[model samples]
Target: MSAARPARLAVGVVSAGRVGAVLGAALSAIGHRVVATAAVSKASLHRAETLLPGVPVLPPDEVALHADLVLLAVPDDVLPGMVRGLAAAGAFRPGQILVHTAGAHGISVLEPAVEHGVLPLALHPVLTFTGRSEDVQRLTGACIAVTAREDDEVAWSVGEALVLELSAEPVRVPEQARPLYHAALAHGANHLVTLVRDCAELLQREVLVATSTGSTDESMVGSASSTSAERVIGPLLSAALDNALRHGDRALTGPVARGDVGTLRTHLRELDRVDPELADIYRVLARRTAHRAVAGGLLPDHAAAEVRATLEEHR
Candidate 1:
């Protein structure tokens, strides 16, 4: 695409799912002309109407035909086929900007369209889409990671403009880094769900056992009853995350980070006694933390050596 003049960009959104509808609406609300969308589900159609008001629900090909910018918010696995189909159907107009919102993928999936002279880009918001109206609120003040082909400056500018219109910060990430970035996000948010569920089940079992024994203290019951899992974990995690983000890797403060080898050994012994399967997890995490501490210059060479030795012995 030519980078001379900023085009009066007309936007078309394909796959009117949660992310697509919310963003299409947000773009429309910001005075960008959202020309059309392709919504497959009734709920998606309802969301499209809510967001885009009277915008037409057109076919996928029509979306590409009408707009200068096209967004593909479909499932990740289906994206390549969709782009190839669009390209085969002559849907991509020359210089049209085609962007997808998949975090795990880079702009390479849009290679078919790129060959057709379409500028490929990616704009992934670092937030989950829960298909709730509140998602619109969540879109504001979010961080979106943008990835574009090195040669496509116009597409990059369009991605930045979209972020600005949404009141979100855009960070340019390299194409090869997309998968690792997405894996980090999934490890943090998705794995936390499994971890929290396991904790909740354990707590419930403990509570039931205590109740059956009729030895549960009133104060203990009250504390457990009044504080939810989220209440207990959210603030603590938020503070740790804040420290990690603002103060860098040196902000790590657990036993491993502090080179408290004896404390780590004690914890590993306890885990082996209570849950043998968890011992490996403890060892691995402690080793990782030790590496981080060493990298941050928080641990001396001797201390790092000791930490690694302890973790290896436990493993």
Candidate 2:
């Protein structure tokens, strides 16, 4: 028999942190009833109060008892224990759906709830939450990754409906691949912040050096230079990202893509003279770029070999 149309269910949110509160509020705004939430911290409680005004803030067990769908928005480390605790407490009713916002975990963590007739799903929004009502609006048009061990038809429809209700796109990912997918996201987005911060510090040092040299550092000139840098860098980076997304590795540019040995050598020499630490990063990235370009048909095997040899020699 086809599963009953997944009801417009009442949702219970556990852990009223940024993701929990924002999602609860967004679902509520989209006409789902957020019946209860568990706010563990003072900050979380305040966030819940702000985002889910008039919604009862209950303990985890109480939330599970009151709602048909439960969202475990707790930290990844705490999720297994929390799920076990709920199961032991007889919190989930038969046929209830339980989900978590954890990207790194799949449905296995919810195994404790499975015997209780609870359907488990992993629904991770790709966008970051700002712990503000504005995030509810921002969630629209975002992308969410979903994985479930339940019937594919039911799981996919439920996930798609929820994402559509939130005005976001739903990408179905395999359960076993979720961790690796999450790792890729973390590596690109999270680590990039550290990289940018380092770049900003280097730029500030450059500014200080220019000022210290008593160069004709007019404020207008500095402002113009900063504006030009922003304009050029922003579009260049955007174009690079667009090309990567559209054409994959084939759209790579610069000396590495061209397999210019002299240019690679000059880059290493410049980095060594200015910042030896960055030289290693440059070399590694350049070598990878060359490999990708070669694979993408942008560079011949011999050219790639020459570039790789140049980088390895410098290293």
Candidate 3:
């Protein structure tokens, strides 16, 4: 039997932060009434104004008093304190849904509110937020990592129903696995931006070198901000990501995969001059990639040995 959905919620966001504001708007879209939210910063206020519109900006406690579902989308570090403070303040009541969006935490972090007969849920959307209206639209087709009390079927059902209302899929994450789940997502998504941008900057430097030496590289026209270079690089990155996803470790390619010691040495020399930090990053990633390639049988044993030796020598 399908578990019964919770009452039609009156939502309250503790603060109209990036994730909070967009999610508040999403709930509003799904026929929930967002009565109030707390927003202090100018950015948060702006986001609330844009996303929540006519919803009143109230104090956290007042917002809590007005809503049946309290969305606590604060930073991970701030969440425990916030929940304790709100509970101490008598802001939570019996049967209130206390949902936090911090990926690193589960319902244990909301334990303080459980004393007030509140239902705790960890509803973490496994996607990035830009605090824009577009983020509301982005919620569709997204995966939400839902962590609920294992013994409470009603809590799990309510969490999944909320996710479905926002047009997202729900993946159950056990309370014990929240930290590891969050770490994996952060390692993949956050570091990916750093990796991609660094590669683009490195390519921009090479393009500058080509142009300064009097070469007519039409592709090198315009600033790094220009789509000219992105046009050349973006498709390559997309294809590489697609291949990596579909084939996993077997998608190995490039100088590291080929075990081109000379090419790697040249790259290290150039990058060392360009950015010492980048050179260090490149060396570490190349070594790891080479290891994966060998493990996947993409690189021969001899090639893997040579690559390892080259990396160790450079280090």
Candidate 4:
């Protein structure tokens, strides 16, 4: 049996937030009709106007009443109450497909709407959104994690069908594993941004110190120096990322990995002088990196211990 209920189904976005607005546009591109959506904040309203032109901005219940497929793209914490409220309001109709995009949850969160006879599904896009037209194209080749109700073969197929409609790959994730899956992605992607920004800040300090003598002071470092620092790190960082992804622990090549205790001491002192918090971050990450390198056989145990001691004593 085909998973999609019908061709050209009317789609309703509960709120045209960043993920919602762009996905509404994507569906519209692939023969689905975005009949209506709910938008409250000024940014959401602007996003709807830009991405979902001609689609009516209706209330959540009204949008639900009008569509065959109701997409609930609100935050994770609010979804449960929102579903219960809509079910209580008689918004869900029998045979309507209810899908949510929260990564942390699966079909369990949509159980309230099941009473209204809606087919529940959890379809999470593994990529971030910018609420722009470009995101529609970026959806191509991206992976979407789907968790459907157990024993509901039809719903699982429907979820995959929807992902295929968007030109993305679908990976089935068991309901129990959703939280761990979400955590891994967040730890890698979200924390990478914070780590990169910290590295750029450190590089900026070096650039500032080099371009100006000690008399100039840190306050005088401007955007030009910041840009220069980023430019200097950009390609190097890009190659390092590529190598790390392709070669794994074999890509470990630095003072810590090489057991250069003197170099590690220098880095600790420099980071401490720049910012105490950053020095702590460095110590923590370096310790983790050395452990992983040793485990992977990239560094001997003795080398790792020496690196650890240098990091521990960098007072």
Strongest candidate by TM-score: 3
Name the regions of candidate 4 deviating beyond 4 angstroms.
4-6, 212-227
Decreasing lDDT order of the candidates: 3, 4, 2, 1
- My TM-score estimates for the predictions, one after another, are 0.82, 0.87, 0.93, 0.92
Model 4 — which ten-residue stretch has the worst lDDT?
A: 218-227
Evaluate all candidate structures by whole-model CA lDDT and list the values in order. 0.82, 0.83, 0.89, 0.88
Stretches of candidate 3 off by over 4 Å are 1-5, 212-228
TM-score of 2: 0.87
Question: On residues 1-315, what C-alpha lDDT tens digit does candidate 4 reach at each position?
Answer: 377534678999989998999889999999899999999999999999999998999999999999999999999999999999999899998989999998899898888899889999999898888888899899999999999987888888999999998989999999999999999999988998898898877766665556644445565545344456668778988998999999888888898888899989988888888799989988998999999799778889989999988887885
Per-residue CA lDDT of candidate 3, range 1-315, in tens?
Answer: 244444568999989999999999999988889999999999999999999999999999889989999999999999999999998999999988899999999999989899999989999998899999999999999999999999998889989988987889999999999999999999999999999888777766777445545535555444433544566688899999999999999988889898888999988888888799989888889889988998888898899889888877876
Clashing pairs in 4: none
Question: Per-residue error at 231 for model 3, in Å?
Answer: 3.0
The sequence of per-residue lDDT tens digits that candidate 2 reaches over residues 9-98 is 799999799999999998888778999999968899999899999889999999999988899998888899999999999999888888
User: What are the clashing pairs of model 2?
Assistant: none
- Please, what are the lDDT tens digits per residue for candidate 1 over residues 186-247? 99878767666645554445544455345467776665566565665667767887898898
- Candidates sorted on TM-score, descending: 3, 4, 2, 1
